[model samples]
Target: MRTYALTVFSQTGEKLLDESFEAPSNEEAKKIGQARLDETGYSEYTHRCVSPEAKLVLFHR
Candidate 1:
């Protein structure tokens, strides 16, 4: 498992959420992010993943 930094932005470029959590892979991390957005009532957003060392990690769209 690895820790991933997550950020979610609304359609109009507003940041709706920021968090850090552990996940097995980037794909799983994205799934979790999406589920979180759905649970939190955010329907449209873009997300980015980052590594603990401040590197940009890519997530499948």
Candidate 2:
């Protein structure tokens, strides 16, 4: 398994949110990010692959 940091960006290109966690693959990482958006009332937020690591992301966006 690997940890990945996801950057959720708004339509205008401004970063809306970010998160990191351990997952079996990048697909799981994306699901983790989607779940976060759903929980935060931003279910429609678009996400992009910023980077991957075994470290936790400090900032939310």
Candidate 3:
């Protein structure tokens, strides 16, 4: 599996998610990120991250 530092920003430009994860692929990384975002109660807001698309990170928290 690959690692990823997941992050998300709310529609209002507020940071709603910040986390690190290890997943096999971008889809899995996104799943992990979305799960965290949902926990923060930003499920209804449009969100994105510094990275346009998920990728495998060599290291993560």
| Error in Å for residue 58 of model 1 | 6.8
Model 2 clash pairs are none
Q: Considering only N, C-alpha and C atoms within 3 Å, which residue pairs clash in candidate 3?
A: none
Between candidates 2 and 3, the one scoring higher on lDDT is 2
Best by lDDT: 1
Off by over 4 Å in 3: 10-16, 44-46, 49-61
Give candidate 3's root-mean-square deviation (CA, Å): 6.7
Q: What is the lDDT of residue 43 in candidate 3?
A: 56
> Each prediction's Cα lDDT score?
0.70, 0.61, 0.57
Task: Give a tens-digit lDDT track for model 3, residues 1-56.
Answer: 76567555655677666666676776666677667666887656655432334433
lDDT of 1 by residue, 10-57 (tens): 667787778888888777876776676678765355767777666666
Error of 3 at 45 (Å): 4.9
**How many residue pairs in model 2 have overlapping backbones?**
0
Q: Which lDDT tens digits does candidate 2 get at residues 1-61?
A: 7767766777798877666667776666667766776787766666554336544332243
Candidate 1 lDDT for residue 53? 67
Query: Once model 2 is optimally superposed onto the true structure by TM-score, how far is the C-alpha of residue 21 displaced, in angstroms?
Result: 1.2
Winner of 1 and 2 under lDDT: 1
